[model samples]
Target chain A: MALWKNGAFVDDAWREIAEGEDPPPAGHVILPLDWWEQERDAFEGSNAPLGLRVAPGVPIERFARDINRFALIELVFPKFGDGRAFSMARLLRERHGFRGELRATGDVLIDQIQMMARCGFDTFQISDATTERLLRERGAPAYKRFYQPGATPEAPVDSRPWARRPG
Target chain B: MYRYDEFDAAFVADRVSAFRDQVSRRLSGDMTEEQFRPHRLMNGLYLQLHAYMLRVAVPYGTLNARQMHKLAHIARVYDKGFGHFTTRQNIQYNWPALSDVPAILDELASVEMHAIQTSGNCIRNVTADHFAGAAADEIEDPRPYAEILRQWSSIHPEFTFLPRKFKIAVNGADWDRAAIQVHDIGYQIVRNEAGEVGFAVYVGGGLGRTPMIARKLRDFLPKADLLAYTQAIVRVYNLEGRRDNKYKARIKILVHEKGVDPMREAVEAEFAAASREFISLPASEIARIKSYFAPPALQARAACDAYEARRQTDPRFAAFAANNVHPHRVAGHGVVTISLKPIGGVPGDATAAQMDAVADLAARYGHDEIRVSHEQNLVLPHVALDDLPAIYDELAANGLATANAGLISDIIACPGLDYCALATARSIPIAQRISERFGEGERARDIGELKIKISGCINACGHHHVGHIGILGLERKGVETYQITLGGSGDETCSLGTLTGPGFSSEEVVDAIERIVNVYMSVRTDRSEDFLAAYRRVGMQPFKEALYETSKGADI
Candidate 1:
């Protein structure tokens, strides 16, 4: 049985669909490679970032220009400590400036969610919904940006006290 | 000793509150051991074998009297009434409750002290020459630059979650007392011919299972680009360093595997990109940091002549004066190294009362200048020559006047298996026994300048590999066996020791060390010839023959 499936992230669903499986309502949903080609024109340029989830070690830098035209970049972490995804996220954010939803797709542990968030992850998709409770295990923020808001500073200037200074 | 301005204060206050929240969550089961581990490690809290050990960052081994008193207070109330000074110049408290960590940090914050980044995979408390500001041959005080590195590496983005923990040592003197070569990256501040300050950069030196000396990656890097340049190096390591095995995750292994040329090119490429962005090294900030390390006004005194005559008269004081007193950079002044490694005592363990006595001496006879060496010795810099007699008298009363600085009796030992939960076998008792054997012996002088380092485990907490005679305790089939290694060093040319034949039991280990010392005495070219030089001369033949029963008369 398949352990994980975010319609926005899953390219393969070997099992039967769940009872309350929701379609792509707000964000981009994934389609298999063959299915993607079959439904190519259905993916709108306007509704962009139809995140085509890919496996690890794929150099996304070559497709940087096309990838930015998307609403989200759903990169997969094959396992805990894979680290290749970290470079991918950093390249997208710092180098390519991919703005909208950058979600961690597969095998990413809840323990590493905070680190993922700190590394510019906006959304997390767990593999096993049965063990989804594992997501709130480490440094899970009870309230978003409550006490030390902007503590996860993406840049040094953002962490600086002079961040509010007039140009 | 970077003073906490409002920004630093708020940052620490917020960080403390965040840690406090994390602790509560862990207690309430919102956070598991796995999740709470990194959070706790980031705050310098560790779950050791016993309870909890808090490693506090004594930035570059520089702390004021107020901070020392606060540390003493923590030791008295929260811990076992003593603090162990580590080889990396940090202080470790063996016992503290998990619940009281926040409160302890609150106490630390009152004195401008902290446990921030003391552990975890971050730029650890940047270490430097303990005698930095007042050393006789120092080119410049490296503390200001160390302070800069500390601020930059603390919670640094993109570099925090590194492959493993990183350590950096800086030195400004020609002699590398800071052990710069053994650090992950070493920086030697030097001025170019054009009167511009830069760095002689070295990469990948570390001591563990694999001890390797760093290679010079850059001849000179401009002062303005120091931070950016460091970031570049870390970035290159972060991008390409191995993550398959935890043991091989250090930058040293990475540098060794990939070779220096490629790593240098990658770092330079990153540096070239980072150079466009200024790190804001302003003259005012430099001046501000320099002001914190104010120098003491020295005066001329003729106590040298009086002390010389007394040295010929009193044998005890003369012995102490000869070993303990060091030449100060200023005229008529001398730096005194108070040996904490007394006979049959823990090497670096200092009680609260001893700390108070040192503080008193600092405030009185000295210029309120107290420094802790990497070798776990307390230094009273800028002591007037005339005040040596009074200072010696005061120290003698405090049980700290051990005349064994750089001598055979000055042993460097960690809180081995006896205290450290991670240890598999005992190391302190072995040291205690060795000290007892040579406690009041004339043999100590006959076999001079020996550094016997004993680590209970391979983690090298006692820095076993760097010792001239390294004793590493290991568990062999549930029995404790001590492994002896030879010729390891921590200087500019660092190399891991080669194991010498079979392991010895705890009882036999001390005899093994004594035999080794005895062998050195027998074959040494002269009294001036130290333990390492003699060991290099005869190899490990005498030591092996003396240690093993089968090799009692064996050939090398």
Candidate 2:
């Protein structure tokens, strides 16, 4: 899988461990939510950075208490049209106040990257070659006007006087 | 009419460019059809049975003369010389080449219009009362709030890929002209005893294979909390609405299964937890939007001698005045509905020439404004009472003065198998036949206010579920069969129609409708009762016996 971050494809430093695999003692690692929940105490002494991979429809509220333990949280979209991850992303950032890097993985199309970014995903895992190529070339088009605020800071107040947000 | 600011213009231009690029990618095979389908639908391009159909948003059905002229140009240049006005108060062009859609989007943007969210799973166009600013009984102009919702819902990042499409309607008048009860979300602009304006919010109402009346969610929501409250509701549905079954994916099903109380609790909890400051509108912004929709300048005057003389002299003009002209907020002005449903004509289909005429009339005598009604008619919302004769003459010249605004012949019919891919049978032909059967002026006027709605299929695009006389066409054993339903209403007293009995073949359906109407005519207490009121009083047994008992007796 290719990782895209900060508007370009980049080499991923975090290694995702499968359910049965053992975690390294000192490297950055990502683990599935179920696996991490079952084996979280085993990595107590390790100083390695931890990340959680959450599948779509998994209640993010369940992990809210332990949210600060991870450096990154990856939200999965099992398919292109399933939007459960979007609400989860917003909840994680806005409601839980998770300041960690949020990533989107699985079925990440070029057309949806901007919305994913707006909903608080800082990184995307692009598996489709066409999407990857398109992102590498033209980049996502940014709309100049937004009517609602999201995880992205949209306003200190513009000329249009509705819902002007303060930091 | 809300004019696009520089930011709004830039937003639409960017979207057009993005769509152009997406179309280019599809042409080059860089994107597959499955991947491109949602993108195209988001821009209101649908691949119908024969060709591509492009649905354009007429936001809250308010348009200026220039925009109407642009639509006429699009119909003449890009489509098949005519456009179909939809029940949602939008317009659809039945034919357009796939390669030409990007250019069409560019044309639409030039007029400050785009098809964004007109289709797809995202929130569709926000509709409002067609007589919003002009209605005498309106509590407030609903278009301002509709425009606010339109902007907030446009390309809404989180709600775009929802489980199913969403529809919202706002009613400002006491009469419920916009059919708020049958929408996914309905807002009734109301005033409290404290004299503060707010909304009575309704949720989870829709018409489709499973019809539902929206339940009241909030007795009164402050005007400022509109966006924030709506966001919370959509967010909850995005997370919890069923995705397994396409047929049961609407918010109605979610509300049905979870029950209204639980759904309300969930939405209220979400609303309570949401950052309301970032989403709800400030008072200044509401005033700013409201200014754009301020009622036109009109001064009340004494009755015009010319208008009185014309009405007294010409029977046609008198009929037009009685049927077509509606009471405006101002005494000297009136609301005129220009019917697209001509006798023996396809419902809602307006030729390019007729569109240009409407635009011209709007510019000259209608306060430079036009409104497309959800009932598939164009409304001149601010017409001078004295100008009725001239306007009627102009409309007659253009074949638009039908004088059947709420009469029996004014039918709502969706483009069924003739154009739609999902339709099981043809709807336009049935509508045409019914209108022809009831074309006689005195007969139709005698029949009085009967709303006949025909849907090509159970999707209810024609809103057959809420029609006073509803016809649902289906395919059975390789033949077209239609089911009739009665007493459905889309007004303030909203109710879903009950099926009269078994289905009839396409050939027998029109006759069945006549039989039903004949029964209504015989059993009605008087002409004052109308079809729905009479049906309510007499019940379906009379009509059912008139239909099936006679057929059973024939068999015997």
Clashes of each: 2, 0
Q: What is the TM-score of chain A alone in each candidate?
A: 0.58, 0.90
Query: Tens-digit lDDT track for model 1 on B190-236?
Result: 88888877789999988777777898999888766667688778877
Poorest stretch of ten by lDDT in candidate 2 chain B: B547-556
Please provide, for model 2 over B1-556, each residue's C-alpha lDDT reduced to its tens digit, 9 standing for 90 to 100: 7999877887788888988988998999978898899889989999899988999999999999999999999999998899999999999999988889999999999999998888999899999999999999999999999999998888888999999999999999999999999999999999998999999999999999999999999989999999989998999899999899988999999999999999999999999998876667888888988999988889886787778899999998998888898999898788999999999999999999999999999999998999999999999999988998999999999999998999878999999999999999999999999999998388888899999999999999999999999999999988999999999999989999999989999899989999999999999888798999999998998899887874565655
What does DockQ come to for candidate 2? 0.64
By DockQ, who's the top model here? 2
Q: How much of the true contact map at the interface does candidate 1 reproduce, as a fraction?
A: 0.02
C-alpha RMSD over true interface residues, model 2: 1.7
Q: Which ranges of candidate 2 are over 4 A from the true structure?
A: A43-47, A161-167, B550-556
Best by TM-score: 2
